[model samples]
Target: MGGQQPAEPATEELTIDQLAAKVGMTVRNVRAYAGRGLIPPPRLAGRTGYYGADHVARLTLVRELLDKGYTLAAVERMMSELPDGALALGVFETLVSPWTPTEPEVITEQQLAERAGIPHNPETIAKLVELGIAERQDDGRLRIPNPDLLRTGLEVIKLGVPLDAIFEMLPKLLDHADAVAKIYVELFRSTVWRQFADAGLPAEGWPEIQRTLEGIIPLAGQALVAAFREAMGREIEAVAYEELGVAPDTLPSTG
Candidate 1:
C-alpha cells in the first residue's frame, strides 16, 4: 500500500457568514475587502470559500482603523505596508485607538440656561459663543463640547465673578494651557517617540512604549494640577499681601 499522504495541518475554517459574524462585518463588506485586496482571498474548497483566523484578525484590524478616523485609502495603504501577522495588528491598534473619547452632549436652549443659571440673554449667549464655551447648532440646540468646563464657568458666575471679566481672562488662560500642552507633546515626540522610531520600533518594544504612553496620561494630568496649584497659591499670596495688607505666612496654617 502507498504511504499515507501527510495530513493537512488542522485549522479552523469559517464560512462567509461565520467570518462576517466573527469579525462584526457584513458578508458583502468582507467580499468587497477581498476584492479591494485589503484582505486575503478566502481558501476555495470547490465552489465554497472558507476564512481562517488570519482573515478574522485582518477584518477586525481594518474595522478598528476605520473607527479611529482613518480614511479607507489610508487604511488600505497601512494594511499593505504592515507585515502579515498579529503583531502588526496589535501595534496599529494600540497606536490608533483613542486615548480618550469625547462624545458631545446636546442640550436644548432651555436646558442650557437652567444649567448655567442664566436667563436667555442674547448678549450673554453671544459672549459665550465668542468665549468658545458653547456652540449653537443649525437645529437651534446648543452643543456644550465640554460640559465640565461649562459647569465650572457657571460656578464662577455663581461666585459673582462678572461674565465680562471672566471672558476677558479666558483667552490668556487658554493661551497658557496651549503652550504647556505643546511643550509636553514636543518633549514626548522628541525624546521617547523619537528614540523608538530611530531604533526601528522593534516588536518587543511595543509593550514598553504602550505602557509609557498610558502612564503619561495620568501623570501629565497630575503634574499640571500640582504645578497650577503651586503657581496659583503664590499669586494669591502676593495679591493678598499687596492689596489686603495681610501676609499669607502670618495666616493660620490650614494644615
Candidate 2:
C-alpha cells in the first residue's frame, strides 16, 4: 500500500558511513555489496550516497541469507528473484543455522574411514578426496581437508549415523561455515595480530599467546559439552514424546 519503506522524510536518510556503522560492515564493504548487487543501490544525493531504513532491512536480509547457505553470488541472484522480504529472510535463516565448518586437520584417509567405522575402500577414499573432505597426498595417504570437518565427522560417526550420510552432508556444511568464518578471520588479522605486531611483542610472545589460548581450550570444550548434553536430552525427549503420543511427565519411569 506504500513504498518499500514506511512513510518517512527523505531528509532523514543515512549516509554511507552511517549505514555501515549501523549494519556492522565497512564502508568499503557496503560499497562493494552495492556494486555487486548484494543490496539495492542507494539513492544518490549529489556526489554522496544516501540510504534509508529499507537499506538497513536489506543488509539484515543479506546477513541472514549468508548465514543460511546462500553464496554472495547466490544471494545476489535470489534477491533479484524474490521480492518477499519476510519469506526470503525466514528461508535463509533456516538454511544457515545448521551449517558450519569443522576445524581443519590432517588425518590419513584410512584413519578417516576407520574413525567413521566405514569400510576402507579405494572408491570411498577417492570419493572423499573428490568431495574435498579429505585429500590424497604424494605418498598415497589422504589427510582431512579441514580440522573442523574431521572433528565434526568423528562426532557424527560416534552418534551412530551412517558414514555415507555424514559424508554427503559434510561438503554443504563446511562450505557455509567457511564462508561465515571469513569475516572473523579478517577481524583477527586486523585487530589481534596487527595490534600485537604494532606493540613490538617479541617472536617468543607468539608461543605464549598460543599456550594461553590452548589452556582455555579444555574449559571451553567442557562448557560446550555440558550445554550440548542438556540441549540434546531435551530435544530427544521431546521428539520421542511427540512420536509416542505421550506427555514427557507421563513416560514410564526408568527407575
Q: Number of the top candidate by TM-score?
A: 1
**lDDT by residue for model 2 (12-81), tens:** 5899999989888888888888887766777887898788776776777877667556798887876775
lDDT of 1: 0.79
CA shift of 165, model 1, Å:
1.8
**Cα lDDT listed for each candidate:** 0.79, 0.67
C-alpha lDDT of residue 160 in model 2:
88
Off by over 4 Å in 2: 1-123, 144-160, 171-215, 250-255
Task: Output the TM-score of candidate 2.
Answer: 0.36
